[model samples]
Target: MNASVLAHRSMLAKGASGAACLSFQLNEQTPAIFPMRQVQEVIVLPAQQITPIPNMPSCVLGLTTRRSRVMWLVDLAHMLLSQPLPSNIRNYNVVIIRVAQILQQQNMLVATAHKHVLLGLIVPTMKGVVRFSPDLIQTPKGHFAPGLAPCLRGCVLQQDEMLLVLDAEAIARSPILQSI
Candidate 1:
């Protein structure tokens, strides 16, 4: 297994904490992180599963089925940078995310409400998981692309590299997703 996977598994074994985060590259030059609490799973896109949706935003890649549930796939790079993944590229990596939690009430008439939605984010590469102390994360400063600032939680410096931590819930609730 890769170092990232090992790191991720080790963190999972350590139990839930804000210090654990999944790290992945948005592109060759950009690295980002997501709180592990929101990530459900990560997988490589199967060749035949991606069914492209027509007339949607360029970022909307399409939909795919995973474990009997339909997942909407969006290209994070395209959404943030307005640069879609190259057409010639075939393999894709996706991070499955659960946006929120559902509250269950036994006596209530409406026992089940659609509590949270699953979203699949297509990224150029998956870097595995990294564990950082909460204190390491610094408040976001400096300028960011207007499109990306809203979803960023903050940034952390790791091994001399800075990684932007993203809030998956914010991305899931973004107006861009609702507009489609």
Candidate 2:
């Protein structure tokens, strides 16, 4: 195996099986991370790829197709902070993630099987994978912004910065996303 891959494996095996996460910027000001295992892939596409859907929540950027499956593209910044991305931005790096089956509600009417539903979260910049020792993850003390609290799994301090670790499953099963 390559040196980088070997290093990643070693990190994953460390500290009671530490969690590996993909760190990204929600906006210029907000930094966050999501479990790497939840992400299927990351794609860079032009703004034109997103077809705007009218009457949808502002957080829902619209729909796009990948590997013949329709995926809902959501604005993570807007969802978390009510701040839409700048209109001048013309491209996005999207993280494609599978919503964990446990997040699906029994009564919800879903067009596709719960396991197949994929969400594309739009992030302006990706900071790469970071591994955190399980011991370093702290249970949130209800100190996060109200909008983001529900979707956050916890927070961890890395290099003096607190990175909110988002719960991808919770985000996928969010009422707002389900209503779409």
Candidate 3:
């Protein structure tokens, strides 16, 4: 876990209320949140930093070194929005996630043996941290984008706006990303 996020978690654990999460703008369009537990770090990565690989998933932006270890970067817009990201962008807003969710339907042994996976998600902008009760998350409406449905935990209303709460584990395990 990132120190900043750990601090945010601790602060919430003490006196603050609800689940702490970071809300980010997906392609500077739809709003979404990631539970703090899955977030390792949030960074601004220059376009030049990534080393492009051949014959990879379209969603994969490429690999970038983070803390001396190489991590694959995925364009969240390309994945969830099912749209091409603008090529004119100069930098990427990356949210590094460490996925180690236990598979509930799997046998206990296999679930227990699961290792943490690292991947960087690129978003257009971040909306800052927010706290919302788990019960507040609701099923997406019929009009919701199909591409984003599987990766979503649910939706929540924040200041009268619908904010999608994403499941990082599901995003990390996405089939398009799996091809990388």
Model number with the top lDDT = 3
Colliding residue pairs in candidate 3: none
Better of 1 and 3 by lDDT: 3
Which ranges in model 1 have alpha carbons more than 4 Å from their true place?
1-18, 101-114
For each candidate in turn, the TM-score is: 0.81, 0.81, 0.82
Per-residue error for 113 in candidate 3, Å, reads 6.0
Write one digit per residue (lDDT tens) for candidate 3, span 85-104: 68888888899998774555
What's model 1's overall lDDT? 0.80
lDDT of 2 at 167: 85
Question: For model 2, which pairs clash?
Answer: none
Provide C-alpha RMSD values for all models, in order: 7.2, 6.4, 7.3
Ranking by lDDT: 3, 1, 2
**Model 2: ten consecutive residues of lowest lDDT:** 7-16
